[model samples]
Target chain A: MVKGLLDWIDERFKIRDLWNDFADRPIPGGSSWFYVLGASLIFIFSLQMVTGILLAMYYAPTPDHAYASVKFIEEVAPFGSFVRGLHHWGASFMMVLVGLHMVRVFVFGAYKKPREIIWVLGVGLIAIVGGFAFTGYLLPWDQKAYWATVVGTNVAGTVPVVGGVLLRIVRGGTELGAFSLSRFFAIHTYILPWSLALLAGLHVFLLERAGAGGIWNAADRVPYKAEPLFPNQLFKDTVFIGMVFIALASMAVLFPAPLEPQADPTDSTYNPRPEWYFYFVFQMLKIFEGKLELLGTVILPNLGVAALLLIPFIDRSPERDPAKRKLMMAAGALFVATVIGLTIAGARAPIVNAPAVTSPSVLAGRAIYARNGCSACHGIFGKGGKIGPELTHVAARRPDAAWHLKHFRNPQAIVPGSIMPKLDLSDRELQELTDYMLSLK
Target chain B: MSDQDVSRRNFMIRTIIGIGAFIGAAISVPLAGFGILPVLRKKEPDWTDAGTAGDLMTDEPQERRFFQTVKNGWQEERVERTVWLVKKADGGITAFSPNCPHLGCGYRWFSQERQFKCPCHASLFAIDGKVISGPAPRALDTLSAKIESGKVLVKFEIFQVGTTKKAAA
Candidate 1:
């Protein structure tokens, strides 16, 4: 019965012939376990798609419900944690596998000749995968996601003339809020996925057309033998995929993804850091400041990508051996080293200090300050106006709390020609303001 | 092959299939149930104590801010909520939800104007929670309030904004 049904379908679809052709395809010389990275990445991506769909079944994209829905998936839904964990870890694995695959192709000189377009497609796939990660990172609507996105979008806002427009487009507005969350959710779940699927299809087709680049070692040339990609290569691919599945499963069970506290835009104490993969770029922002910021954030990164895309055009050599390609090898090594160094530096950077405590008197004083528009001239913790000295460490400089009380009542009494207005405050208001100022230290 | 050997092989196959089906069902049933359970769960109404009744002045509206623990799905968070408390002439208390009837922005009591004003869109409401002027579609939402042992407690509920009728959200 099954044979008859398959025969009926095969007449139109050529299913059996296609399977036979795929199974019998010839793998060129030097195909080994090293070639499994690409296949493994495809498997992981399939897993991510499955698990991501399952998650979207219950996820709510609104600002009020996004965090709550994720919490439901984590703590309430059965096996929800497992599914979410797989998707989360699968993303990281996909990134690592893509990197490893790119490295393998570069070292083997696969990007040299006929496979240049495939290499370009591979780069596009990497970017789409990265876009996947970035968009998905904000869907949880937690503090880490919120602040990281705020910083990430702000990085795009530094792109010279088009910066502001790009920022608005990426965020859907000037600030990160409901619109931002919804936009990210839509991109993560819809737009990027479809684009990635299409590009991935083209990428695989191009790769199949060019065939595997094969191992490039000089010593293994004589003994190298071409083999059919059936039981031999297929067996190895299955083993690698199985091992990866086990590792992913173990990771899903062991270290589930953490859902942090809900996002609070008013709370400035939270320190935002990007995911580990983005640490290098985040670190670059620190090294390059002011007008030179564009060099690190935009120009350099674009130059690197452009160079990579134009590799085949620049290096027209027929040489496939890494030993002969001394310059390319050295350049690749330097780039890798720089990225690792920057990532390490970013990871080790000091955290911002927490905001001061909000005692009753301090709260009252803060209210009084807001009411009197004191922040109009004096800056607090690097925010507000900069016409006057920063009041972040003001109490430390002038420890005598009574002086601030007098200054608020009459500014010229403390400093002649202070150009500051005198305030009318009750004794309790004066004391509360003094408490708030003293606490700033 | 002998008949007994064939029977034993068939028995083994049957056992394996049974176990596989059981395991599959075991994982899937609960997953489907949990996934749909949140949609079916009803939101339980809760009242939180605002403050002592003595703190409110007669015929005067005072803004009281307090942290209320709100539960949605599996997340429970303490969010600060503000309400306008008014002590009526009959010694009764009426609590108004702070969210404006215009666009849900928090409205504040303007002592000089003696009216509630939304800073976002300039919506104005009378001290008695009536719409006075501006873009407000209706009066301020009045929350369910009760006093026990001289303590004021209010049942806080969010209402749909930009509408003349008060509808719970």
Candidate 2:
């Protein structure tokens, strides 16, 4: 009966031809694991769309109920946690697969003359995927989401003349509130998803038109034999997708996505940190301070992205072999290393959470210390730099308050060879800092 | 084809485009308005009764939970909300928002510590809602409160967090 229905539909729509065109296409250089990244990305993207829709059924985008709605989806709805987990992990997987796919394309020089447009489309799709990560982040209305988005929108506010306008547009208002949450929801669920789908469809259509670039190392070789995509590329793609599914499922079952406390814009001690994927840029911002912040925040990042997008045009040479493309290969390697290095640095960066203390004076003193950049040179609780002696045990060594006060006033006078500069501060600040240092014991 | 026939065809095409554009505008204008108008309109303040002013103690903060009908978009529903009511030594009542000024984490009044401490960030506030210590950019947010017929009516408002100036959110 099902076969008869399919036949009946095929008679009107020519469904068999469509299946033949999709499944039995000739693939030059045949299938390899290197080619599976794109397939895996598409699979995960579809999974995300499905799971995302399910979660959206219960998610209220307003500030008043966003947190409650997410909680309902996670705890009350049947298989809600599972759906959320798949969606969560699916995002990360998409990011990873996109990166791998880009690398594969770059290594193979797949973005040659005929495929330049395809590469540009891929770059655009990457931006959309990033948009998904950013805007989707704020939907939960949790502390991490709120603060990270605050920092994210603030970064947009650093653009020279149009910065304020861009900030307002991105945030939907001056402050991150009901409108901001709703706007992010609209962008994440509606705008980005649809844009990605459209661009991704064009990208695949163009890829099919250009055909596979085939064996990077063997691009110069003559008359390449073609094999049918059915049971070959499809089989490999299925196996890899299955493996990814298992891995994502295991991760979901073992370590489900965490829900932090609901967003509180008033929590001053909470430091806004972006996701792991954004760690490289986050750490780069720390390196570029004050006057040079725009270099890290906008100029350099945009330049890098521009260069990535224009790779096919920039490297017009037709060479596809890695050995022949020495400059490009070296640059790619350096970029990867830098990203890994910065990510590690960001991971190890000191968490600036305020210590739990009841004393008002001590709290005041700690704030003063933080404001003065004492952490730059002096180590505290084994964190921070080691240029100066560790401040953790300073009170135990120097029990005199007057001595500490004198040291703050004139470091050189208190310790003749002391390299610590005498910080220009008022008497009240010195006293409070002294009291705080003593309380550290 | 005759000139008369061409003119007739042109009229048909133009009319088709005109009607198509009219239909497009008809659907899109309302859709855009539906999506954006609510976000732009100023939200009206709603006051909810907390409790009797006579039941509060001096120098102590009490948690008050009340259900207020919140009309968000098309949905009108009663949602549970909270406010910390502190009876001052001067026989006056001050209502404080539960959110910490640091990053918006809910804070609890610690009687033992004699301060309101946020669990997420440890921002401390004195009984008077002054910033005692930690990373709070400003003091605790105070809601507008008044006594009417021995009952306390509080108008809860969210302020922009992590800022020195208190701007309505």
Candidate 3:
């Protein structure tokens, strides 16, 4: 009777006993640092989702109430500011981690052999992040969101024949009105997040199946060994998340987000620039717009994406060691260097002031503003929206022609952290818009 | 080559195979659960119409209520909401939400701006619900309205909106 009872207890406890076991895969020291990047990215993404849901609990998407709701979250909700801060910092964290993850993948040759799909997924991830940045920029519904979106849409119009259609689709019409915002909000808050979650799951599952590439594969001499994954490696993941949280907390404390004044649609001389990540591409496009504008703006980026996906195919050799793969090393370095240079160029690009113009140009300017969807971001009178600024008095604010030109040339210089992308405008358009903006009393 | 050694080798092979099976089964247990999630998830959204045809008066914004019974896997939920149906001067109809675009607050028709306005954040919309001022991210959604026997009908849904283009409606 005693033996039978003991056997029954053991049978019932079998599965519970099984899960308590763990395994380890030998993760190298260099990989240890690199591992933190992916883990940190996941941590931040999870945090963003959680906080976003909390915000959504109280968020209203209507233009009339979005700002007040945001303000209410910041002021009245319990720990609301903290939650918002987490989301804000989390986005920045995602950007940084993605870059680092890309670098790590490149250097380690992790994207090679049986991993082209993984690399392509990484590119897809960036595209989603870009979408995220674009959509989130408008959430504050302040000057930065409004003007930046205007410049962004205008730039989209520069893509040639299909450009007009693409611009219209992106803006949800010729003007940046209700449709555009709705489309963007749907894409940002609902669509992209679900896709990302699905893809991420796939990516992780594939990585696990492929197993850790192991430090020895890169070391040439030391053969790879499987190490227990739990206490040995996963513990470090826990620690990494903790560190990331602390860093995010520090950033939150140091720099609380700012709320810009309302966007003024009548402010034709608006300044707009994208976030730092896109600055390099923006700068590259400006130089190339002189020659192969479409190639530089669209085709080239698409090619880069293709190349990233094809890395595993091109890198047929099994040499995981960066030291052994000279060609890949040089290529990776060049790519990184080029992007960095372009970023610097984008940062250093000069802002030109708008040329001085007279009366008719000013009237033409108003027409341009009305037609171009500038109202979506910039406010008209003291009324309207607040993505850019109230342009009803912009002329009094910055009366100089040169100042207007500079504002149009590079918005980020005057207002740092603005999401307003620079536009490819004709000199005539720029001057007229400036004149009109300055004419606003 | 010895008889005892041959037996030992055979016994050792079987023991190893049994242990390997145990580990494989152990790993598959978690994967099985993961695999089941997509199947168990809520049903994907379908195109749904919100309200009736002529019930929406032209030149005025009317709040029409909609109800839907959605089947998500084995469970079902009956959802209801009030969405805006606007009939313009051109005799065209656009359906949208009475919910504010900013934080989802209810919006009212402001005769002054000739628009729908959210009082919470001072958001003002044009007569057509185009955002004239305030923090709304998008124009009010056009609810799919249908008329049956001159009565207006609306379909409401419990939807998840995030970074993608999916709507649960």
Candidate 4:
């Protein structure tokens, strides 16, 4: 049996040669913390696949009882919570690492010239990974994913020209409905993986062919010796991996992800935000709202990336020494400054969920909630079961009664395509519900 | 001019044109590949079992997680997956992903609304993943699911998440 298995394996993948090639090569820059982010992404992806598979074993993708099933994964499946934890934290880390890798390449001018194709591939990878984060974000079907998807897609549809068509394709129809999950899941697990793997293989292949190139090496003229990728760099790689794992594990342990309320489509105050890496971009777009949505979201960033991609071709100073690359240094500094500014803007954006915490008007809100039979589809103050996002945080999150009133009266008016129906309410009823809702918090 | 001078000039021109064509072809392949990959990988609409029909209960969603070991390309190993077996109030059955369509957030069926709503943004859908309201782009995706032996199974392909089928804009 052992001999037969060995023969079968050899006849099939013939992976020995691939492994040998990897073993033989010495990577540019050998083993360094800087080089670890890309590899960490691969590690996280693998970890995500495994954990996702495990979670899926017990997960139900149906909007009905979706959260209940996830709760089962947390409570029943063997190491199910742990597995979900791994997948969750791993995803967050991958986004961070991917972002860092981009910045590293930018600063090092690794995308310059002969490596332009790689840079293009890198950009494509980043976008795909963001999609990965987005799709994966909804896998839990909790409050955050539900509200975020709605807000996120609304923003997506604002894109010009083919935006509507693109929106339809993504939702698998007109709204974020059934086909959307199917489409995203298929994309996430099937399409995205294959694309990423192909890109990853190609990226590494080119890396091997061209080696790592940058201004640091130009002064050396002579290609310096690098440690064999096997033991030397591998050990360092292992150390970095260990550090990442510990950090991720700590996060997973300290705060297992919180499941927000079941989605209700009717509720306003769906304050959503992207993962941290996206926070800066999200923040940039927020600032651009009502002013330069197009330039901020589409044109400006694309131009920045374009410049980054063209760095290798431009600034072709004959010198390779880092000390001599003053213009290149200045350009890098400018880009970093820009990104930092956007991130700061994002971090400081008006807190959409703060004011509600200060006010309490549960009596008025509860009256309306009861009158509307919101309890039928939603659980409130831990009274109802899983049907929609618990309104426990509604007041805490959306404090302004007037804003909430405007949002509640006809959410679709304020938020186009909102699932919430416009409630026919007198000003008194609105204020009463708002007060009651506020009191619950 | 001598033969050497003429030959050298022709050689350089040809080399440049050859390089340009190669670059153009290289770019085109990836662009075309991106467009065609979806069509190429679409699954044939065929019946695949999700699990033992007996395991599914009536009027409530039963979470079924299943796995299979198959050989595809170079890898062969057991892969796990999940789906919900929703027995409708009228005893009808459907299997769907908990993932909501509104921005890919997971959604739960609200027995109260007799609809599905996203907890993240309040997007509502009917029992079957239809967009009942709130920022949803489409309805729930239905899996080609059924029951076979006393076992749960899915037409499983362990694909990488976070790639493919991009959102608009």
Candidate 5:
């Protein structure tokens, strides 16, 4: 019965033939466990897409609700925590797999001839995935996400002429808020995924067209022997994927993803650090501070990406053996080593302390005041526009918390004709600001 | 010899299948339960102390803050919560949740104006917690409170923030 149904479909769709063409393609003799990296990357990418979609169903993309929504998913949703853990670990896994695959391609000189386009597509995929990671990091609206984004956007603002514009565009305003969250959610969920899916499809198509570039059989001075892809290579890839799944599941069950404190834009004591993958770049900023910031933030990184993309054009050698490609091998190795070294150094670096202040609520209140744009009119500690009365000693002058609260809710209610705009704050936020004002005395 | 060997082979095959099924169930059942249990769980509210009745002045609203441990699915965190305590002239004590009656933004006490003001949408409440003006659809949501040996104990509950009526969350 199944055979009859399959035959009926195959008559119009050529399903069997399509399967044969895709699964039964020829693989080279030198293919080994090392060849599984690319397939593993594809597998991990699909996992990320599935888990990310599941998460998006519950994720709220507004500054006011983002943190609470993520908390809901982590604590209240069924298996939501596990699914989140999978997505988190899967991102790191994809990075590792893509890196390993790129290293394998470069070392084998697979990017040598008719395969230049594939290499270019692969580089583009890396950038897109990196972008996916960066944008997704802020969706939870936690302390880490907020502070890291602040530092990241500030780095963009250091670019020579268009720095200020780039910073505004990335942040969606002068600071991170509702607009920034929505913008990141759109890019992370919609834009980058579609772009990555298209680029990945092209990459696979070009890869199949060129065939696997086997390790050079030195004695014959030619490529290794060819083998069918079906049972041999595919079987090995399946095993590798299963092993990766087991590892991922175990990690998800054990550690799970962390939910840090809610993002506080007003808190200044937070020490912002980028994810492990971007630690090398973060470390570069430290080494090249002040006048040399542009060199680390813009010039060097772009040059590295350009060099990676143009490798096929630069090295036109026919040799596929690493021994024959001395300069390329050395440069690739050095680049990998430096990145690893810098990442380790960044991780080991001591945390730099900001000026310590007692009372977190007071600090939070100060942040709320700034976020609500109160400083635009009122002067505090002698800095700000003097249009409104200085708030430095308002607590002592009034000594009534209720009056301040009523005035904040309705400026005209307390002051009769007060023009101070009503500032909307949550119950917790109101108390925070009240506490801060009371402390001003 | 042939009969004996056939029986032995059948026994071995059955044992392998039995073990495989056991392991599969061991891994899958708990995982499935973990994925489904959160949907069935109910949230319980906690009662907390706001402050002593003596700490509040007559006809004045005082702000009190405390931390409540919140447990959701797999996460447990201590979240800061706040309330407004009013010591009425009649010697009766009343506690109000800080959320404004209109859009859920916090309403503050304006001592000079002797009223509660919500900055977000200009919602106003009197010192005794009645809606005075602006977009509020009702009076401030008051929590259940009791005085025990000079300490004011209040049953803290969350209500739907933007609702016209006070609905427990």
Candidate 6:
């Protein structure tokens, strides 16, 4: 039945010839496992496409419904959490694969001579992937997503000349609102995907025309023995894809994607951190602080990308072996090392102006406040159960520290019908807790 | 390659195939559930107040248009719905769904013929909602309706088309 059906369709479409042209290829060197990275990336991209479409069915691109819709998908829809989990983990996987693929190509000297166009297309693909990550991050419209976009757009605003216009264009207004969510949704779902697809198609077409880079050390003069890519390379590719699938699926099942609290534009104390892949750049901003911030925010990153795109032409040596290209190889390794080191540092970096720097009394008061469960009703720094009035600006309401101390001692005496219980705390503890309360504002 | 090397490669391929199948199961199970579970789940009937019961008290079927707040996905949309209400000889109100049973076309109440005529498929339903003289497989579907405080309320629903049974679509 399948053969007859294939014959019927193949007669009209000539799918056999197309399949042969695509699959029947020869590798200059017998297929190696290193060639599997690109295939794994393509597979992950396909997975992302499917999961993204599924998510879009449930997602609403507006300020009012975006967070609630995501919540509904996660908590109500069947298999919604798992599908979202796959997409989230799949994004991280794609980033890692893209990096690995680029590194593999660079180390193999595959971007030299006839394959320069492929490298250029590869660079464009990388930028599109980065665009995907940035836009996809904000679709949840949560605290982390919103703040990260604010920081991201602000970073763009640091660019000279057209920074203001660029920021306004990106945000769709002076502040992130309905337009920002809708714009991000459109870009993430429509614009970036189409661009990536077009670029990737051209990249693969160029790759096929140029063929696999093969063994770099294979003497150009000699005719090296070649093996067909069918069972040899394809087997390796399938195995690698399968392995990646297992790891991604495991991660998705174990730790599904998280949805933080809804975005609160009024909260200034909330520290926003970019996704892990962006840690290097985030750390760089910290390194080049204050007046020199423009260097890290704009110049260095652009320069790095320009350098990468120009590498093949800049290093004009015909030698493909790493041993022969010592200086270039060293520079590449150093760059990779620096990025890794900075990422590690960023992960461990302490929060600026954290409560640790506060006076001893304030620190003791924070501990006392926690012990007394004061946060149950009164919220500070945007963290609390919030059953009562928020205490984020409590100091502004009651400037006198003595009033707080008195309120702690006797609730009904200070304010009639006050629901606050009289805490049996020591005088020192009361003083400390009051100090912590005053420090909030 | 040596015989041992071939065997090792085969074993590796088998292991990879096992993992591939595991991954397939993981994805397909969730995907199947995601697609099917929502469809299988029953939707609660949402009743909307169409108009005043006294206004619709007549022998002829009255077409009442009302806005219904419907929760579709995460959005709450106000959709315009129409229902044909008929005041019987006993004075009890019967609300008929506006669509033809054959293919879900909007049917009109023709007072001259005293029947609901569908323009799309030419299906005709009598004032009593029975198939008068057309290709309609069953009678016109009735909406769950009640009169409360001089207001006519209707619980709107869509039924499966081209079917003998009045199953909810």
What is chain B's TM-score across the candidates, in the order shown? Answer: 0.74, 0.78, 0.59, 0.59, 0.70, 0.91
**lDDT-based ranking:** 6, 1, 2, 5, 3, 4
Where does model 4 exceed 4 Å of error?
Answer: A1-18, A27-31, A218-224, A315-320, A353-441, B1-169
Give the Å error, residue A348, model 2.
1.6
**Ten-residue stretch with the least lDDT total in model 6 chain A:** A350-359
Model 3, A407: alpha-carbon shift in Å?
28
- Of 3 and 5, which scores higher on DockQ? 5
Instruction: List DockQ for all candidates.
Output: 0.12, 0.01, 0.02, 0.01, 0.07, 0.34
Tell how far residue A345 is off in model 2, in angstroms. Answer: 1.4
Better of 4 and 5 by lDDT: 5
TM-score of chain B of 6: 0.91
lDDT by residue (A317-406, candidate 1, tens digit) is 988899999999998888888988999999998986645545678778878877888889987743467687668667767779789988
What would the per-residue lDDT of candidate 3 be over residues A261-379, giving only the tens digit for each residue? 65565554555666677787778667764347677777877788888777888888877789999898898898888888998888777754434333578789878887777887887
* Cα distance off (Å), candidate 5, residue A433: 23
Tens digit of lDDT per residue, candidate 2, span B83-148?
999987876789998788788999999899889998887888999999898999998999988878
DockQ of candidate 4 compared with the true complex? 0.01
TM-score computed on alpha carbons, candidate 3: 0.57
lDDT of 5 by residue, A1-441 (tens): 998998898899997887787766776653378788888888788878877877776678998878988888788676778888888888878878888999999998889789999999999999998998889889899998998888887778778889778888999987899899999999999999999999999999988888777666523645545655654566566667767877886787797887789998666567788788889988998888546868999999999999999999999978888898899899999999988999998888788664423378878888898888889898764446779987865775777878777777778878887788887877788878887787664
Model 2 bad stretches (over 4 Å): A1-5, A217-224, A355-441, B1-169
True contacts kept of 6: 0.52
Q: Which prediction has the highest TM-score against the true structure?
A: 6
Clashing pairs in 1: none
- For this target, which candidate reaches the highest DockQ against the unseen true structure? 6
True interface contacts reproduced by each model, as a fraction?
A: 0.26, 0.00, 0.00, 0.00, 0.12, 0.52
Candidate 5 residue A193 C-alpha distance from true site, Å: 0.9
Q: Poorest 10 consecutive residues of model 2 chain B by lDDT?
A: B26-35
Q: Supply the TM-score of chain A against the true chain A for every candidate structure.
A: 0.82, 0.81, 0.75, 0.73, 0.81, 0.79
For residues B1-169, write the lDDT of model 3, one tens digit per residue: 5998567545644554554454346424433432344244554444455655665677777776666677532235666666777776776566665666566677887655578878788778876666676666666555555555655555443333221232443
Q: What is the lDDT, from 0 to 100, of the residue B154 in candidate 3?
A: 50
Please give, as one word, the docking class of candidate 2: incorrect
